[model samples]
Target: MASEFELIARHFTPVVSGSRTGVCLGVGDDCALLTPRAGQRLAISVDTSVVNVHFPADAPPEAIGHRALAVSLSDLAAMGAEARWCLMALAIADADDDWLASFARGFHELCAATGTTLVGGDVTRGELAIGVTVMGEVPSGQALTRDGARPGDVLAVTGALGAGAGGLALWQRGERDMAHPLLMRYLRPQPRLEAGRGLLDLASAAIDVSDGLLADLGHVLKASGVGARMEVDSVPMAAGLVEALGPDAARRAALGGGDDYELLVSLPPDAMDEAVRRLASQGLALTPIGRVTADPGLAGVGEIGPHGWQHFHGGAS
Candidate 1:
C-alpha cells in the first residue's frame, strides 16, 4: 500500500502546484494559507458524508467527490458568498489508487468551474467518509443570513424542490444511470452559487434547502422570529418528478424529502419580482412558494405530517 503522503502527492498535490491565485500556499504545508479579497468577510462551512448513511457504499467515486464539495459549497451559497478554496479530508478502508484518481477528477473539475482552489486536507484509513470544508467571501455587511427575514417577506426558492429526494428514490428503486436527470440531481448536486450571489442585495434572508423544504424554511422562520404560510400548489416540482413517482409520492417527496440544495429566501413582497427576474436573467428559476408568517410551523399546506431528514433521527434525505 502506498504511504499516505504518497497517496496525496500522487492524486491531490498536482492540482494545486501551479498558478496560485488567492492561495499563497497550497498542498505541501501543514496548513493552507489563503487570502480573501479586500473589504470582504470570510464565510466557512464544513460537511461530512458517510458511506451508506449519506450515500450508497458502491456509488461511483466521481459522484462521491463531486458531492462532497458541492454540499459544502451550498452552505456558502445560502449565505450569498463567493467560493474561494476548499479542503477535503478523505477516510477510506483501503488506498485504492484508481478510486482516488477518479474522485480527484470530479472534485477538481468543480473547483476549476467554481474558481475554488484546493489548499489543504487529510487522508486517513477509516470507515469510508468524506469531509469537505469550504471557504468563501462576502462583501462586509452584505452577507445574507436567515435572521433578516421579516414577517411579511415573501418566501421563495431557487430551481425545483424534491429533485434530490426524487433522485434518491429512483436510485433506491435500482436506477443507476447517472444520465437520468433525477439521478444526476441526487448524485451530482449543482450548488446555486450564481443565483445566491446575485440575490444577495435583494434577499432579506436565505438558507439552503439541504433538509426538506418545510424543515429548512422552518429554520429561517425561527431565526427571523417570523411564521409562514405555504401554498403547496405554488411549490414547483422537477420536470419528471410527477410522472416518475406518481402524484402522492411526489408530493410527499417535494414537501419533505430533503437533500435539495436549492436556496430558500425571504424578501419583501415587492422584491419578489426582482428576485424572480434576476434568476431568469441568469437562466435559473425562482418561485414564490409561501410568505413568512408568525413564529413557525406549516400553515397554508395544512394537515401535513412530520417531514425532512435530520441526522441521528433515522430520517433519509
Candidate 2:
C-alpha cells in the first residue's frame, strides 16, 4: 500500500526512539546526527552480504534479514561496545512485498531483542545485496581489541560451535529434515552480546568467530604479537552436532567452519573464573579452550588435526 521509503519511515523510524545517548536526531532527516557521551568512544563496523555468497539465494527472507544484522552486531560484541544504532543499504534484484515483509519482521525482532535501533538506510534496485553499518559506544580506552592479548592469557569462547557448518552441509545434501539442531544454528546464530559485554573489563582481547575459530583466533594472535594454544578437546560443541556428523566432523566444523557469530576472547589467567561466572549470571556459557603463549606463533592444542574453514581454500570435509 505504501512505497518502500514510506514503509521504512512509518514502521522503522519509530524504533529510533530507543536510542538513549549519542543520537541527536534519528531517521526521517536528510542525515542522522549522533553525539557520543563525553567519556565514551564510538565503534562502528559495516558488513555486506551478497546473494549466494553469505547465504543461499533461495534462503528464507527472514533468515537473510536476521543474518544481515546479526553479522554486523557480532563485530560490536567483539569490541565490547554497547549496542546503539544501525543504518542499512539494500540492493534488490526484485521487489516482492512478501519477501520484504518477512525480512523486515526478522530484522526488527533482532533489533528489539538486542536494544539496537535502525535509524536510517538506503534502498536501491540492483543485484541482490545487503549492507549494514552498525555503531556502538564504550567507555574510552575500554573497547576490546585483537592486539591486547598477552602470553599466559586464557582463550575462551562463548557458546557452542560447528553447528552452522554442519547445518549447511546437511542442507546442501538435500537432508532438510536432518533431525540435527544444526539447521536452526545455521539459520539463526545467537550473537554473544551479554557474554561480550560481561567481558568488557576481563577480556584482554576479543574477536567474533565469523571466519572459523582457528582462522579468526589466528588473526587475534597476529594482532597481539603473540601465540596461542587451543585445546581442541575443550572447545565447546553444539548439542547433537557430534552425533549427527561423527566426532571428527563435529570437530572439523567447530574448528574450521565459520558463521557461528560467537565471541572468542583472551583473558588474564586470574580473570578467567570471574569472567565465566559473570557470563553465567547472564545465562551464557563461556568455554575455556586454551591459553595464550609466548611462542609468537599459533599452535592448535590437543587433537586438532587441522584448522577450520578458509574462504578461498574451499570447504574442509
Candidate 3:
C-alpha cells in the first residue's frame, strides 16, 4: 500500500492553483497561507459528508467528491461570495488508488469550473467520509445575510427546487442508474454561484436550500424576525418531478424536501425585475416563491409536513 503522503501527492497536490489566485501558499505547508482581495470580506463554511449518512456507501466516488465541495460552496453562494479556496479531508477505509484518482478528478474539475483552489487538507484511514472547508470573498458591506430580510421583501429562489430530494427518493428505491436525471441531481448538485453573485446588494437576505425548502426558509424568517407567505403554485418543481412523484407528493418534495442547494433569497420588491433579468441572462431562473411579512411564522403552502434532512433524526435533506 502507498504511504499516506504518496496518496496526497498523487491525487491532490497537482490541482492546486500555482497561479496563486488568493493563495499565498498551498499544499505541502503546515498551514495554507491565504490573502484576501483588497476591500473584500472573507466568507467561509465547512461541510462534512459521511457514508450511509450524507450519501449512500455505494455512491460513485466522483459524485462523492463533487457533492462534498459543492455543499460547502453553497454556503458561500448564500453570502454572494466568489469561491476561492477549499481544503478537503478524506477518511477512507483503504488505499484504493482508482477511487482516490476518480474522486480527485471530480473535486478538481469543480475547482477548475468555479475558480477554486485546493489549498490544504488531510487523508486518513477510517469509515468513508469527506470534510470540506471552503473559503470565498465578497466586497465589504455587500455580503448578504439572513438577518437583513425585511417584511416587504420578496422571497425568491434561484433555479428549480426538489430535484435533489427527488433524486434521493429515486436512489433510495434501489435505482442504480447514475445517468438518471433525478439520480444525477442527488449525486451532483450545481451550486448557484453566479445567480448569488449577481444578487449582491439586491437580495436582502439569502440562504442555500440544503435542508428542505420550508425548513431552510424558516431559518431566514427566524433570523430576520419576520414572517413569509409562500405562493404554493409559484414554487418551481424539478423537471419530471410531478410525473414521477405525483402532484401532491412532488409538492411536498419541493416544499419539504432538502439538498436542493439552490439559493433562497429575499429581495426588495423594486429589485425584482433587475434580479430576474440578470439571472435570466445567464439562463438561470429566479422565481418569486413568496413575500416576507411583518408577522412571525410561515403561511401559505398548506400543511406541508416535515421537510428537509435532519442528521440526528435521519430525515431526508
Candidate 4:
C-alpha cells in the first residue's frame, strides 16, 4: 500500500474529468492547462477554512466538506457564472481514514450536484485547514459585477436572511435543540446558483451575501461608485428568526450577520417585474429590499438596523 500522501496524489488528484471548453490538460501535469472559449471569460475564486477559524476542529467531516465548497461556489454565484471545476487543498493534522472518506464524499456530492468537477489539488499534513479554488465561466461581457449598479436600480436579495446567524447564536448558547431548522441552515447553506443564473441577463450588479447584507452591498456600492437606500421593512427575514431572537436581535442579525450566502443584486426599476418573474419561473424569489441612490453615503430607509456584517465588531465564532 502507498503512503497517505502518495495515495492522495495518485488516486484523489486524478479523480476529476476534463472539460471540452475550459480544460486543455487537467491532471497529471506539472501545471494544468486551460483555454477559455472565444466569447467566454473564466471566473476564479478561492476560499479558505481553518479548523478553529472557520469551524470547530471536531466539526462533522461532511459538513466541513460541504461548507468548504459551498462558500467558494457562492463566489461563482455572485458573478453570475456557471461553476465548472474546482481545486481542493487539504492540510490535515492527522491521517484519519474515516474523516477523509466522509469529507471526500461530501465534497464530491456537492460537486456533482452543481455540475462541477474536482480538477486538481494537493494534500498536506498540517493544522487542519482546507482551501477550495473554484473556476467558473460566463459570457465575455455578460458576467455581472459589483460596478454596474446605477441610481434607481432596485436592491434585491434571492432568499431569506438571519436564520444562519440566529442558528449560530443558538448553537453557541448550547440551545441546539431550540434552533431546529435555523441550525441546519447555518451548517448547510444552499448557494443560490439558479437565482444567479437567472439574474445573469437581468441584474446590473451582483454579489453574494457572505459578509452579511449591508457589508456585502457596500462592496457593490464601492465597485459601482454609487450609494443605496434600503427599505427596512422590505428586507426579508427567515421565519421564526424574529420569534426566537426577538425583533431587535433578529433585525441586527439579519442585517449584519455573515455567511448567509444569498444573492444580492441591483436591477433597473423598469426591469424589476421581469427579473422577479424570471427568478420565479426557476422556483426562486427575488425580494426587492431597496434602491440605488445618487447620494454617496451608506444610508437606509425606514429602520433597517445597522447595515450588515462587520469583521472586527464581534460576530465570528
Best by lDDT: 3
Backbone clashes under 3 angstroms, per model? 3, 3, 6, 3
Clashing pairs in 3: 212-257, 212-308, 258-317, 259-317, 309-316, 309-317
What are the C-alpha RMSDs, in order, of all predicted structures?
Answer: 2.1, 3.0, 2.1, 2.8
Q: For residues 80-141, could you state the per-residue lDDT of candidate 1 as single tens digits?
A: 99999888888888756788788888898899888788888887878988999999999999
Residues 160-185 of candidate 2 have per-residue lDDT tens digits of 98877887877777666524488777
Please provide, for model 4 over 129-178, each residue's C-alpha lDDT reduced to its tens digit, 9 standing for 90 to 100: 88999998889899988999999999999878887687777777776453
Question: Would you estimate the TM-scores of all the predictions?
Answer: 0.94, 0.91, 0.94, 0.90
Ranking by TM-score: 3, 1, 2, 4
Candidates' C-alpha lDDT: 0.84, 0.81, 0.85, 0.79
Q: Write down the worst ten-residue block by lDDT for model 1.
A: 308-317
What is the C-alpha RMSD, rounded to one decimal, of candidate 1? 2.1
Regions of model 3 farther than 4 Å from truth: 1-5, 15-20, 305-317
